[model samples]
Every structure is written in C-alpha cells, then in structure tokens.
Target: MSETHDHSNEHDHATHTHDGKPIQEDPLPSLEAQILEASVRELLIEKGVISADDVRRAIDQVESRTPALGAKIVARAWDDSEFKALLMSDSDEALMAFGVDMRPTELCVVENTDEVHNMVVCTLCSCYPRPVLGVPPAWYKRRDYRSRAVREPRAVLQEFGTQIPDQKQVRVHDSNADLRYLVLPQRPAGTEGWDQEKLARLVTRDSMIGVSDALAASDIGG
Candidate 1:
C-alpha cells in the first residue's frame, strides 16, 4: 500500500501555526500609524508651523468638553418651548446661553418629531461638535458608519436599537468642516412635569447623535 499524504493539512500547518500553537500575526499598523503621526507632529513643531504648546492647549480644550453639556442643552430645550425654538434656529446662541463655547464650527440642531427622524454623520471626516458633545465615538469615526449612515439611515439606526416607523421620514445629515449636527430627540411621554435637571438625565450621548432615543420614563427609575 502506498503511503497517503495530506498536502492541505501541511499547507495549513505551515501558514496558520508554528509548532503546536496557532501563529498570531502582529497587529502593528495602528501602532505604526501612531508613530508616523507623532513623527509628523514633531516635524511640524520643529519647523515652527505649530508649537507644542498649541497642540497641548488644543488637546486640553477637547478634554475639558463632555456630553453633560449637551445633555443640559437638550433638557432645557425639552422643558422650554422658547429655548427649543432658539436652539433650532440658532444653536450657537442657545448653547452660549448655557456657557458652552461653540465657536469656529457652526452647530445645526435637527429636531426629531413624530413625522421626522434625524441622524448625523460625517462622510468626509469625523467633524463633530466637540465643544458640546466632546470627542466623537470610535464607531462614529469608522468609514463603514459614515458611508452606511447616508445610504441607509433607518437600517443604521435599527442596528443601534432605534426603530423608526416606515411612515415617518428619515433624514440624514452630513457634517462637514464648517457645520456639525446635533439631534434634538423628542421628549419622552409621561414626563410632562419633569424639571430640566431630571430631564437632562434622560438625554444620552447616543440620542444627541441620533443613533438612539431619549431614555424612556421607565429607564431611569421614573
């Protein structure tokens, strides 16, 4: 009898394993990209194009911002009709009233209603309202989300556990360098007498991004 050989097994063993354990490939691209970015930043600083202090200050400013500020704005809007009107018309002014410094980038507030649902995305890049909502989430910066958001917003929202009825209009906003979007989620029912502070607790970061709805009355021990 001739000895039988399994070439496919040999090939798999060679490519996918070393000794008895599976070979793990080095995931260095992210580290390499970070190193390249640091190198470029150092070069720019050396060239006097931008100073180290400038970078530090910018980072500090970004770090100082948080989603709580956005929640306050949303809650105020939900409680006060006049503020909601102002927010929809001029978000910067409305935010300024709350002591939020949203300069340089114009904020466009999209209101979610019974008839219309809104979603925000940055197709070109992750341009977001950092002053109001802090840094964009990692998932938001992904190319897949940016592309899919505009292409199929309802489906994207569904994945985020937000189900919009077919009868309602789904509006997708693409944020750019000059303009960023913030979604004003509809006020939840059964909270008619809720104060701004209590209402703010119901406004989540994801709701402001339009990926989820405001916390229901039952969600926050209400």
Candidate 2:
C-alpha cells in the first residue's frame, strides 16, 4: 500500500489466524527501546514525576485491552440498530458507550456485507486500533502482510482459508497514526432471539479484522 491513503477506492484479509485459532504473539520491542523504556520509568519515579504504582497500573491497563472489547462492540451493533448506525456514522460518539476515548486519533468502523468484504492494514507501520482491538496480531505488523494485503488481498485471504466469492468486492483500509479502523463483520445467520452476551460469543478477533466471518451459531451449540 502507498503512504497516501485513499479510502474511496475499494481494495481486502490478512488473518491474525484461521478459524479462531490462537495467533502468534507480537514480538517485544527492540532491546534498545526496552532499555530506554525502563530508564525513563525509573527516572520518572526518581523525579517524583510518577510512582511505581502508577507504572504498574498503566501496564495492567494495556494488558486489559483486548479483542473481547471489540467483540462486545460488534455484538451490540448486531443487536441494536440505533447503536450500529451511530458506530457507522459518529464512531467516537458511539464508542462512548464503552467508555473509550479516541481523541488524538479517529476510529473508522467499516462493515462487511454480502456485496463487499473489508480488511485493515498499516502499510507505513503497525498503526492499529489499540483501544478497541488491543494489540494487532503479529502477522499484521510484519512486512509481508503490510505489503501484500493491499496488493494481493484475495491471495492472502486464501492463505488464511478465507475464500471470498468473485461477486463480492474486497476493500482494504490503511491505518495510520491519526486514523484507525475496525471491521464490523456481518452477523451470522441462525442467531435469532439471541441476547447481546450470547451473540458476542460468535464474534472473534479475526472476524473483526475481516479475515473471516463470525462463528456460526452451531459452532457454539446455539
């Protein structure tokens, strides 16, 4: 993908994994960066800029950010039409329900439908929707996926065992520092009369990434 982002053109899925399998974890930062972080943390504590407790709390907060949050958002969108419209329109306002603040950056929610499939990638870097989807899967941050997703999305999706029909258009969105995206996958069938909580079980990280569809209701014995 080019550095220039053109949202107008429809572009497509690199999976964090296939069929909800556990994806490889993202690698740690470079040793230099790690050392720098530690030094900065200690210096802050020494200078009374922040407490050790504060550091621990911040670590916990980052750890707590996960795909489950995004799943809840998707499930809510499926169950509540009004909220879904808000998400598709004013995403920041809709995200308020989850107590998420996307101030310096904006979250754009793209939906996958029968006619068009969608995917997210950061060609420039690993700019992801962290507050909503947590850390991106390791593959999403790799050079191969970053480059190939926009060029050969259908082939990439095939590698992930996702076969989009020829009739459906595949669209790829490039994420950046100031803008991020989350794929609002289509709700699966056979889920009538399901509550939000129960419906949430069908949502998965890969589906929200647009690499695959939500878990079939029968998959969970629903």
Candidate 3:
C-alpha cells in the first residue's frame, strides 16, 4: 500500500522501527542524489518553503484512512442484487446507497467474471477512485506495473500469483482522467448460508483488485 511518512524534522526519521529491526542504515539515496536533494530542500527551507510538518501532515492524512467508501460499495453490492444492477447501470446512484458520491455519473464499474475478470490500473499517474478506494497501492503506482499491466495484465497478475484460467476472459481497465473503475469480484460458492458480515470477512483486498475471488466460509478465520 502507498504510505505517507513524517519528515517534519530531520530527527523524525530516527524515531521509526521497522519490524523490530534496528535503524542501522538510512537507505535514503546515493551521495550524489542526496546532495542534490539536500540542496533543493535547503533552498526550499531557506525560502520559507512549506514546512516539513505540513508535508508530514498531508502524508498522514493520505495514509491514516481506510478505503471505507470502496468497502461500503462492495458490501452493498454483495447484499443487494438490485443495487448491484443499479451499480452496473448507474454507478453514481449505486455508490450513494453506500455513501459514496462521485460527481460525474459517467464513472463505470466492471464486475469480475468467471471468464473475464477486471482490474484497474493507471499507466500514467496514480489516478484512482479516491472518494471510494482511497490511494492506490505502492506497487500499483510502480512504472513496471503501470507500463506492463496494460500491455500484459495476465503476465503481471501471474507475477502476483494470480492465475487466470486459460479459458477465462480478462478485461483490463485503463483508468484515465475522465473514467474511474472498481472490480466486483465474483461471490464464491458454498456461501449460500453466509450473511453479509460473514461475507465481508471473505472479501480480501486482492479480490477487490480482481487478482483473487472472494473467499468461501472455509476461508474465514475465527
């Protein structure tokens, strides 16, 4: 996932712990890159450029929230077929049911199919349904993913250990400025008796990304 870090003060970097690992290496940048970056930073600092705290606060705001809007949309789709149909026909109104209101009703949502699964990727920048899914994943923003996914989505999905059956269809959604997309993964079998809460637990983030399908009761934990 994309992460925002605090850089309010130079010393702030010293306060973090990564998996209980000691902060031995800074792993920031090469000497050349560092000098260049520092010069630009110093210039900005000298010019009374935006404070490090402001930058840190913005990053915090981006990372602190969950994709509740996206989750709500998905959950409601799972619960109501009529709404799901509406989501297909009119995504804006459908999103409103779950408290997601996108201004342009032109937005589209593609449901993952048994033969054709759908995934969202932005080849340029991290264009996303922020009102719903929040920020995109770090990997999603990587050049490799952005460049190759549109060209070879199946290959990238395979790299992520997601296999698309040979006979199944794959639809790659290229998210640009005007269009926004979301994946509605196929609900799993053996969930006939499952309720919405139980079903939500089965909705893995990967499933929403169309890399995997929702889990059945067997996949749930206590």
The TM-scores, one per candidate, come to 0.78, 0.83, 0.69
Q: Write the per-residue lDDT of candidate 2 for residues 1-222, one digit (tens) a residue.
A: 222233235421222222222223333345655677889989999999999999899889877899999999999999999999999999999999999997799999999999999988887668888899887898888867777888889988999889999999999887846888999999999998999999999999988888788899999997
Model 1, 27: alpha-carbon shift in Å? 13
How much lDDT does candidate 1 score? 0.81
Cα lDDT tens digits for candidate 3, 1-222: 113443444333222323322212223333555677778877876788777777689878767655555655676687889988998998877666666666662557788766788877765556777666667777776656666777788888898788888898888887767877778888777777656766677776667766666666676753
Model 1, TM vs. native = 0.78
The predictions' CA RMSDs to the true structure, in order, are: 10.9, 8.9, 10.2
Give one digit per residue, the lDDT tens place, for model 1 in 1-222.
102334444332211223321212322234445777899999999999999999999999888888899999999998889998998898877887877766777888999999998889877667888889998898887766877888878888899999999999998888856888899999999998999999999999999999999999889998
lDDT on C-alpha atoms for all candidate structures: 0.81, 0.83, 0.68
- Candidate 1 Cα outliers beyond 4 Å, as residue runs: 1-36, 43-54
Candidate 3 structure lDDT = 0.68
Please state the error at residue 136 of candidate 2 in Å. Answer: 1.9
Which candidate, 2 or 3, would have the higher TM-score against the true structure?
2
Model 3 root mean square deviation, Cα atoms: 10.2
Ranking by TM-score: 2, 1, 3
Clashes of each: 0, 2, 2
Q: What clash count does candidate 1 reach?
A: 0
Q: Kindly report which residue stretches of model 2 are placed more than 4 angstroms away from their true locations once superposed.
A: 1-29
Worst 10 residues of 1 by lDDT: 14-23
Model 3 poorest ten-residue lDDT run: 14-23
